[model samples]
Target: MKTKISHADVLDITAPSGGTTSGLAVLIGSLFGIAVTTNVAGDTVAVHTSGVFDHVKEGAGSGQAWAVGDAVYWDNTAKRLTKTTTSNTKVGYATAAALTTDTVGRFRIVPFA
Candidate 1:
């Protein structure tokens, strides 16, 4: 079975290079480990290796080479951690905000579910 923990409200995010924190992913009752990024448009993060982004961070470093199927949890933001497996298109409501700068493979949370 799978689940998602969403916050009561959305948090305002701002950054120099659109670096504001976006949606977060975390297991129920567990601590968050990664940040589900969102851009200023207020949407779920789209994973792509287009190489047209500005900044991307994953695991322990920043880069532009994330795997296509990588998953990221939320972190360091001011809101509650929310982890979900509903994927992007299937989710009814929009996610926080995601900039295409983050690498798909690099922006991962944990290995197991």
Candidate 2:
């Protein structure tokens, strides 16, 4: 364990263009996580890489319904979560079922999911 670094549940990284907000999803390169603090672009912000969160999800006409344990992906372009895997980063699994009309759902953040 001597070579171990700090616990990685939270990471400090430079914010991307347009900045990042507290309690929102952030996708840097291939790494995806939830912002733990708000910061302007280029500034360092703490991002939580794990745990359950309630976040915005693609809803209704544009997306499909979700069931608990369903794989979830982060749609950075739309700044929301979706069940669609194409061109999206898998962040975690759905912690709660979400109807097609639901805009937000419970998500469990799994590192490198």
Candidate 3:
């Protein structure tokens, strides 16, 4: 016997606000994913919801530095990833260290179910 697994997890959702672009972070309800294309408000766009992605760009918290193996959280309010635990949602762990000079940080997608 064999089992099949589904890999098609990306979904199309309407951008709540205008100016959504590729590589930008988006949130729908409690779901978080990266935008795959430019979308205006009310326009349908593709969002990568799952799977391991390389260099999945995200904004770093102001003056916050990240170290390898540190647990990361998504600050929805700021639209950035942060090491702070106050009112932030867990996204994943940092694969590499992030410096204060860096505007964006890379992280592995380990979405909470």
Candidate 4:
């Protein structure tokens, strides 16, 4: 089948302040998406904003242990995933547990409605 519009969840958007790198988590207002490529300030980069993505890189909360299926939120200020509810936006659920010592945690991307 031929169509004028293509289906794509990932999009090319201007990088936010501080720039961004591939595999890093990014937020535009309350929306959460993953960086698909590296980009400096004012540059455009591809970001995957939807679907179930596995092993999405994120920061681990201090001394916080995550269990599989735990609800995860995006800490925009910190640009990481956390179990803490303080000023965070709900992004998705934890696909893998993170230990206290782990600096990064893997998550599944389930875009917020």
* Candidate 3: C-alpha lDDT: 0.72
lDDT of 4 at 108: 74
Q: What is the TM-score of each candidate against the true structure?
A: 0.19, 0.93, 0.74, 0.78
Of models 1 and 4, which has the larger TM-score? Answer: 4
Candidate 3 C-alpha lDDT tens digits along 12-32: 888876547787777766677
Q: Give the TM-score of candidate 4.
A: 0.78
Please give the CA lDDT of all the candidate structures: 0.30, 0.91, 0.72, 0.76
Candidate 2 lDDT, 12-56, residue by residue in tens: 999999899999989988888889888999999999988899999
Which regions of candidate 1 are displaced past 4 Å? 1-28, 31-61, 78-113
| Model 3 spans with C-alpha error above 4 angstroms | 1-8, 51-63
Return the top candidate by TM-score.
2
Q: Give the winner by lDDT.
A: 2
Q: Which parts of model 2 have CA positions greater than 4 angstroms off?
A: none
What is candidate 1's lDDT per residue for 23-74, written digit by digit as tens? 3332222322223464443344332211222223332333323334434333
- Candidate 4 ranges with C-alpha deviation above 4 Å: 1-8, 51-61
For residue 104, model 3's alpha carbon misses the true position, in angstroms, by 1.7
Clashing pairs in 3: none
Better of 3 and 4 by TM-score: 4
Measured by TM-score, how close is model 2 to the native structure? 0.93
What value of lDDT does candidate 1 attain over all alpha carbons? 0.30
Please state the error at residue 91 of candidate 3 in Å. Answer: 1.7
